[model samples]
Target chain A: MHHGPAAELGKDYSIEYKTRLGVILFFIYLLVYAGFVFIGVFYPDLMGITALAGLNLAFVYGMGLIVLAIIMGLVYNYFCTRHEDKMNKEAEL
Target chain B: MIYTVSPSAIVIFVIFVLSVLGLSFYFARKSKSASGYYAAGGNIHWFVNGIAFAGDYLSAASFLGICGMIAFFGYDGFLYSIGFLAGWVVALFIVAEPLKRMGKYTFADALDAKFDSRAIKLTAAISTLVVSIFYLIPQMVGAGALVTPLLGFPHWVGVVLVGSIVIFIVATAGMTSTTYVQFIKGGLLIVFSTILTIYVLNNGIKLTPNEDYHKFQTIPVVMEQDKILEIESDSYHLKTQHTEGGVTFVSLDNQGIETWWSLNRSGSEPFLEEALSIVTTADGEKLYNGAPKTDGRFYQVGHASKIIRNGQEVTETGPLGPFEFIEAIENTDVTRFLKKVFEVDGNKVTVFYQTITPGKDIMKPGLYYKLGDKGNLWSRLDFLSLMLALFLGTAALPHILIRYYTVASQRAARKSTIVAIASIGLFYILTLYMGAGAMFNGGLDMESSNMSAPLLAKTFGIVLFSIISAIAFATILGTVSGLIVASSGAVAHDLMDKYMKIKMTENQKVNAGRISAVVVGIFAIILGIIFKDQNVSFLVGLAFAIAASSNLPAILMLLFWKKTTSRGISVAIMVGMISSVLIILLSPTMYEIYGLKASDAPIPLQNPGIISIPLGFITLVLISLMTKKHRATK
Candidate 1:
């Protein structure tokens, strides 16, 4: 009846830092996404206004959320990987 | 709409399917072990896995359903795209690393990692099976919808064809073959969609793409002091006139053929306009456009009725930029068809009449989500609930979580997720253009929105149409195979090996998994046939809701909270799964399905995520606190 993670975290010294960074980025994206659902529900007509370029707020805001997710994902990966390398190098030394 | 089977589509479809089977057979040798059969032996490269993620996630619902919805309803379908892509953020930031570090085979492996409790393994395994089957229905149904015009086969034939192919794929090589099939499908879907979007932009907006687009034969009428008068046109003979619902309709007889036309009044002048109608006579023979279904008389619909640039009206706008196309549509008027069904003298008649709607109005939330004049508070709640479920669902999906285990390390998992987000996001952006193209071009088939993307491809030429349809079939094949693999893993690994404690060799485990794949594939084919006529996107939304409610609560709590006990995890999964399914069964949409009035349903909300998701979290917290002292003493 033994059950645990199939692979251990080993000597990954950046585990604490990575979890903190992941949680923060998750909340940041959650708020942005919640704002979209909010406007879509209550102020739907406001979305029809011309916002960016020539498209309506609905189109612009919706596209903005998608682009922001991509940016945040890449940013999360870059910083997390850098920290993992840095902390593990310090631990080895 | 009547469809003609394309010979090129059949040839292309056979080739695409054969290549997929060939990949499966080639990879079969590598998956002899249980680990290889389930998770590809943790050997897939990060980049290939990333595109495979896109291929597995896109499903037929994303390409066909979303495009059709946007084509018909404008921007509401784009809302689905935005929500679906945003869910990847959850997977990338929170779930990817820990999930890869913990699980070996299935999603249940991750949840059961914290405790060796049999209840935890059983509940998690059951939840995975439930979510996978729910997700499989839409992909299988979409396969049937595509085969009708592509290979000109019956719906059941398509269902069986896809089911049998997917079964063979999963049973032969498992995750290795599924991943490669998805990688190829994902790459082709993105490249060809970009090509189709270019064609749409190149053609631009046309008031009449063809000669007969606006030629519905409008004739002016003469009246003598509101008394009997002779019509001005000698071509058509007015046979009979009737008024229903305060609108007048005249039955016209032309060369021994009779059809219905609506009367329109322009200020003080009256005119007769020909309309499209499908009639089922008392003898049970169906007619399309006042002719038999095989007559090839049914017309292709949806076009820009009016095009404008700046402040002036124009006939066409040539080769506009991406942003310019949206601006042009904003100032133009498009012809959208609306349907009404009525019975006259035991004969059922459905008429599709044209309505000229402003582009500004069409590009808003009113069409599908309905926060406009026709919508009330409940509609807004339904919209919010669906968006919430879609956002939370992706990371919780069993099939998606298992992909995190296929890579070598947690870092590869994170990188692959980013790749998925980028590719899937770009494809979604292309969907907005393809949808608008179908909306303005004469490519819409009113019967099924799932046909919109392929039908839009047909307007370019048969070669593009054949290739796009084959890619769409591959899209379905890739997704269905993934779902079957996930389900088989749940059955053989979680349910049997872990819970039942069936002492078996590695060979026996792989054999059991292959048998499970066959069973699950057959079950999916049956459900696909039963739900053949259901909307593809709507079913996908339900799958998302169920996953978000049932699986997300337990996974989040197990990872982040110290008080999450095995009892809490098992009970919460059941409560979440049962309550969500119950609420859906009692929702207004189900009431309509039962042939009852929507308002007569007890629950007002169409989506149960707003309530059921919170309920799951609450149940887990209460149960864990109650069992805390008991567990400590034990």
Candidate 2:
């Protein structure tokens, strides 16, 4: 929300918020690696199966990951903005 | 090989193009600011950016070239997809956040962050232009390739059309419009490709007996002594040789061959009988399509089918999976399938199969080796080097690096990159299926492998074909715009302003960037026209090689090395850029693609990364050490 060094450095954020955000990112990372493992092990036959005109399931999943990444960013932005706003109001009071 | 473009295809193409243009126009107003134009004002949502990343990264080579290669060759083509996806791990884990945090506008920005030197700016700018131009050629060629089947136009016309449209896009909106275009194109590419892949799985594989298919006719003719004649047909052409045997043997043209077979028809009978042909020469030389005779007189006929597994006719018959298909070929006696060659009434033709074994000379460096050999070390290494370049080059690219600046925070950069990787990974996976489907569906073109995916779509219906082709065209436009923007920024911000010391205001710099975009656009158009026939994927590989060799070393060293100087970075960039270009120009690819004499080439082979990439790092390190004393004294 606020455009300065404080936000980038995480100077104003509480430890709990930081930890929560970190956990979320970690889960996302886990999900990605899990997807890779699943594709590698579970469905080797369908790994590169062409399901559409010129695309396969693997390609679709890869694109899906990209979409999920963007959504994650927006969610992070929204939460961060709200947290910052709440903190700012408390400080004023 | 003859194709008839239906009216539905034309209408779909028009609609797709209009939609893309409309998006560009809508975003035109937001792209006025330098930050907005070059980096989308750092405001793009991560998810949209992620898909756009996939769209921008996939290019024509990934879609067309890789698929065609796989359809023709075996598992070797899929290696490219694996290598490409593997490179993203490097982007995600190593380079993403750092790159976003370091630069503001261009790749040079990141490299020049620690040292504000003119030399670094100039060399980095030059590398950007060089790599972008190299990358542009294939996209243009791909555009031309698409137009031929979809709109029935000459290759040059497609190149010109893409050039004009891309130039207009870049000159008007720069990165902002480019990103949105890529986003839209990426989404559509994935969606439509998904639909097509499902169709393939549902239809599954059907065995068409040899007797139930139309056969291609092979014709043999004598040319002027020792002369090579390229037989041209409305759809495809056959290349054959004249041996000691008489000229009655005609080789079936594999490159131009497009086999069409129906799955089920209205007739009460389940299967229909079709003609098959074979020609045997007087020299006792057996030919499937066309090969010169050795001992016996040539005999030609139709309606013959003896499936050979490995030069022997097979007794077994059934369905096969991907691996099984190859195994079947390896285990059984499948010398050749009987096919017919069309001829006018009262015309004589010869048909034979030329035993094609891997040539010993093909192991050597040059276009002859890379395109000829299947599993040789050098060929494999050539592919490896290309994969390395593509993987490493993404994070190091000036245009791609600039995307980080569009976001608000380092975390955003990291998040956006993660998304990009996922999308990119998914899309690459799809390419394998798309490519393999085209291979078995009997839609592949041996002469031009790049058209495999689109032509495969044509088998389903015209509407699907048009939409897929149009999206592919849009894919080219999105990528070219990004490249042009990066190159133009280099020229304006790094070269003219920094190296030339023009001392221009921000507004002037922005204007200069626009002008440079026009210039780069013009340059790309010229190169695209010149290199019209080469594979788009191969061209992308060359671009990757240049990027890896020139940019990667400088960026990596600057980031981790404490004592790296401006002089070292500049020297490394110049050395890498110059050496790679010189090697590639002299390599065998030039001879093959450009028709240059191999002896005349400066380098022996196509890939220079094996030597030049390391040399770039060494140059940076050594130069940094040599210059360390001067800085210490100062």
Please name the candidate that would achieve the greatest lDDT relative to the true structure: 1
If you superpose only chain B onto the true chain B, what TM-score does each candidate give? Answer: 0.94, 0.78
- Model 2 residue runs over 4 Å out of place are A1-93, B209-213, B216-241, B244-377, B597-602, B629-634
Two-chain DockQ for each candidate model: 0.61, 0.06
TM-score of chain A of 2: 0.66
Give all candidates' CA lDDT scores.
Answer: 0.86, 0.63
Q: Which candidate is the best by DockQ?
A: 1
Clashing pairs in 1: none
**lDDT of candidate 1 over B1-634, digit per residue (tens):** 7778988888999988889999999999998988789989887889999999999999988998889889988888888899899989888888888788768888888887767778888999999999899899999999999998898888899999999999999999999999999999999999999999999999899987655444566767765644325456777787666566655666677786667676666457887767777889999998776678787656777888788787778889989888888878888899887666677778787766666789997777777777845678788879988998899999899988888878878888889999999999999999999999998887787777888899888888899999999999999999999999999999999999999999978889989999999999999999999888777878888888899889999888887888888899889999998888898889987888788987899999888998888889999999999888523111
The lDDT, on a scale of 0 to 1, for candidate 2 is 0.63
lDDT per residue as tens, model 2, B79-194: 46655665555455455555665566788877776667778878899998888888888888898888877887877888888888887787777788888888888888888888
